[model samples]
Target: MSGRLSMCTICPGENEQIDAVIKIGRERRSVIYGTVIDENRDPVADAVVKLLQVCDNGRIIPLTHTFTDKYGQFLLGPLCPNQKYMLKIYKDNITIRYDPIDAECSDGDCIGNKCKRHDSGCK
Candidate 1:
């Protein structure tokens, strides 16, 4: 009893809560990850993945953008937790059809906590 040792194993107590517990943030992150595919389901490298912010009244604003890797895989964010966003793909008309993800959805996952919300391209 000399040394203080405590095992704080945080389990959701069931399978359903696994994802819930893992994503323990005030605002659950909007993590959008996928491969840029062409019409034939082939990986397209250097494709653009655009993340646009939506206004309170459902207005689309221009946000930052990124390019997919050689594997056609791209990581949109570590974006604002529990925030709404519009994700789009460019350079080949790659329409992104994924649910918005944020920065708080993992117990030990490494994601940026920075609020990279740019005020540019706002109308």
Candidate 2:
């Protein structure tokens, strides 16, 4: 009768009282976390990572952004499962755009590479 009810319906009755409870299950969200490295495979700290969502009408919506830590590690999360997203990394006056990444709902981490070719190694 409390705590995140998905749906509730009540019916009238004559001289009668009743209590009904409805429950719904929640799906797990997706998270994208990875490290950003340079051509020499060195961690690129202070890099800007942007997560974008592209609409069918060719409109790009910026979902979230994060900066890499000293170890060039970044995390962007709680995203919708089974959805596609674009990752844009910026560092040292250079921009790297990766292809659309399909986010899956799982506990496993999604590791990607940030190289000169912008190959994210995401499927």
Candidate 3:
């Protein structure tokens, strides 16, 4: 009876399969395409990009906006889970403004084309 009680109370290693399982069960990280360019497909730095979450009513509500880096790379979320979104890119001189692009969603996350979702947008 004593041995049974001790075994029942004893805990396994803290760094074992349990930890790995928990980690795996956690939400997977999301990614987005991150590059904008001119007509020649060359990197266009310092461009502004706007991000919006698409509602069921088809309304375009602004979420956030970011500027492209020297490499013309930008990132958006972690945005709303299981929601569609759109992205718009703008350059003052090099080219005309771009229409918003539809964000592709997988799992509970979203990826902005040429954009990275925020690291903590998921809830």
Please give each candidate's TM-score.
Answer: 0.49, 0.52, 0.52
Error of 2 at 106 (Å): 56
Task: List model 1 lDDT by residue over 14-37, tens digit each.
Answer: 555454333332534456788988
lDDT of 3 by residue, 22-99 (tens): 122344334345899898999999998998878899898998899999999987656545678888888877467789
Q: In candidate 1, which residue ranges exceed 4 Å CA deviation?
A: 1-27, 92-123
Q: Weakest 10 consecutive residues, lDDT, candidate 3? A: 1-10
In model 3, where do residues sit more than 4 Å from their true spots?
1-25, 28-31, 94-123
lDDT ranking from best candidate downward: 2, 1, 3
Prediction RMSDs, each to the true structure = 20.3, 19.4, 20.2
Candidates 1 and 2 compared by lDDT, better number? 2
Q: Candidates' lDDT values, in order?
A: 0.71, 0.80, 0.69
The better-scoring model by lDDT among 2 and 3 is 2
Q: Top model by lDDT, which number?
A: 2
lDDT of 3 at 101: 88
1-123 per-residue lDDT for model 2 (tens digits): 123325666886899878766567764677788999999999999999999987778888999899999999998877876677899999887689989987863334446943354446654
Task: Find the 10 residues in a row with the least total lDDT in model 1.
Answer: 1-10
